[model samples]
Target: MSKVEDFEELRPLLFSIAYRILGSVSEAEDAVQETWLRFDGSATRPTSTKAYLSAAVTRISIDVLRSARVRRESYVGPWFPEPLLADPYEDPARSAELADSLSMAALLLLERLSPLERAVFVLREVFDFGFDDVAVAVGRSEAACRQLLVRARRHMAAGRPRFEADRQERQRLATRFLDALRNGDVGSLQSLLAADVQLVGDGGGKSPQLAKAVSGAENVARLLGTVFPWLVRIGVTFEPQEVNGQPGAIFRHRDGKILQVLVLDVLDGRIQTIRGVINPEKLDHLGPVADAWAADREVKQARREWG
Candidate 1:
């Protein structure tokens, strides 16, 4: 195949690799585009296009992540990865690993690793790339790459939640949780939540967000139960969707503008964590973002009128 054909064929895999490393869909796309530019400008073709492009994107992403970490140090409120609606690449042999690593929880765990370690783990553990290819991708010797993977695995294992494997069971629990949230049914909501469950938000100081993470099933249940009813009063609606390979929902305004993305961490038949990403900058890729400040005002007005 020609250069264009080979690059296009590998685009999805390249994006997946970059996204895992950087955790930003926009940054990952940028890395892929930059990789293509370098490939196109090269005087001669490499022996393996896959390895060549993968290495280019991984190095670019590692550099981007190093700079990004500095910005995140001063970011307001909690930070979460931009919501990914669907992963473009698929390998039947690695489906389970792909699904597990693409989760919001998994991505956040990966944030604990150094960029090199993260890249090594993604290429070797998640994508099942060979040691030689992994070393090439991250610009490390095979021995160094193995050490990076070991550290990555240790860090990830320290915080990884025991994810529920039954997809139907997860969906069923999520369905009940959403239904209870819609109806303001605190009892039903609490029943589905783990006793230590936490509700957190990432609004980046640009929208409404929790002052801090709210923990305990009762506290989380009550907060969702009270808040969602008011949102419903103002014509906000949520549609269930898969986000980052887990059951989630995209909330929209009455006019259908994007409001936020809510993802659940379901484990052992109960919801363990509830995460909401409401930063407009992080959400614009999904659709036209809603003015969350205006939405807050509308909710307040509706509350006063109801009283």
Candidate 2:
């Protein structure tokens, strides 16, 4: 195939690799585009187009991540990865690995690793790339890449819950939870939550975030139970959808603009965490973002008048 054909064929894989490393859909797309530019400008064809493009995108993502980390250091409030509606790449052989690594929890875990270690782990562990290819992707020796992988695995394992709910069970619980939330049924919502469950919001100081993470089943359930109904009354609605391979919802303004994306992390038959990403900058790729500040005002006014 020609250069364009090869790049297009591998685009999904390249975007997936970059997205895993950078946690920003926009940045990942840029890395993939840059990879194509380098490939197109090359004087000769590579022996393995997949390997060549993968290495280029990985290296670019790693560099981008390093700078991004610096910015994140001073970021206001909690940070969550831009919500990914769907992953373009699919390999049945590595389906389990792919699904597990795409969660918001997994991406946040990746944030704790050094950029090189993150790249090595994503290429080797998640994508099942060979050691030689992994080494080339991160510009490290095979031995060094293996060492990085070991560290990444150790860090990720330390952060993961001991027993996570399977996909079907998690979906079932999310459905019930969303139903309870819509009804403002705090009792039902609490029943689905783990005792230590936490509801975290990532408005990145650009919107109305929780003053802090609300923890405990009662507290979280009450907060969701109260706030969401008010949002509904003020013309906000949510549609259940999968986000980052987990059950989630995309909330929209009355006019149908994006408001936020909420994802649930279920473990051991209960909802362990509820993550809401409301930063407009992060939501832009999903579609037209709502004015969250204005939405907040509307909610407050509706509560006072409707009550």
Candidate 3:
């Protein structure tokens, strides 16, 4: 295949590496574009285009992440990675290795790392880059990179678990949780959640949310129970959709307005973390979920109209 074809074939992998490191879809795309530019300008043909591209993307992501930290430090309220709608290319193997990579809990925990540590951890753990490659990409020696990984691992140990539920089991639990929510069963919600489950909302001060993270399953349950009644009063509905590669709910008001999106992080067959993104800025990529619900509504309407 031509170099152009080769580059096209590797775009998805490149984007995945960048996104995992930077945790921003837009920034990932930008990093990939920059990688292509560097590839095109190079004098020598790349020995392995994939490695070159991955290295370039990782380097670019590290720079973007460093600059992003400056901005986030001054943000209006608590910051969170913009949640992504799950795409077909999500690697099940990578997902399994990095249980919290796509989890809101994992993203929040990453905030504790320095930019270089974040890049190193993502490359080593999530993308399976070798220590040497990671060191090269992050400008560290292999031994130094190994130490960085060790430190990152220790930092994440508090949130890490010995076993994580399979995707099917997680979906099953999420479905049950959503059903209970729709049915107004507070007991069911509480039962599904881990006792210490925490709800972290990222409204970015652009929407309504508790000013700080809400902890404890019972407290989260009470909050959701109270909110659900008001939602029912307003004729709002909940729809199950995949968010950040996990089962989640999108709230749609009667007039077809989407108010919020919630993604759960399941661990050891229990709901351990809940991330609610009500911020308009973070929801922009989600793209008018009302339209998605309307599409479903249209199909249902057609079935009735035809029947």
RMSD of each: 0.8, 1.1, 6.4
State in Å the error of residue 144, model 1.
1.2
Report lDDT per candidate: 0.93, 0.93, 0.76
Model 3 segments beyond 4 Å from truth?
87-95, 98-100, 161-164, 254-257, 289-307
Across 1-307, the per-residue lDDT of candidate 3 in tens digits comes to 7777988988987877777777777788889899988988888887777777777888889899889888888886677777777633456677675445766567667778887888888888887888878887888899999999888988877765332557788888999998878776888889988989888877776666677877888898887765565455546788888776677888876776776888887777778878787777666666664443343455456546653
TM-score of each: 0.98, 0.98, 0.83
Instruction: Return the top candidate by lDDT.
Output: 1
Once model 3 is optimally superposed onto the true structure by TM-score, how far is the C-alpha of residue 6 displaced, in angstroms? Answer: 1.7
Q: Put down candidate 2 lDDT per residue, 206-239, tens digits, no spaces.
A: 9999889999999998989999999988888998
| Tens-place lDDT digits, model 1, residues 1-307 | 9999999999999999999999999999999999999999999999999989999999999999999999999989988999999999999999999999999899989989999999999998988889999888877899998898889999998998567899999999989988999999999999999999999999999999999999999999999999998999999999889899999899999989999999999999999999999999999988899999999999999999994
- Which should have the higher lDDT, number 1 or number 2? 1
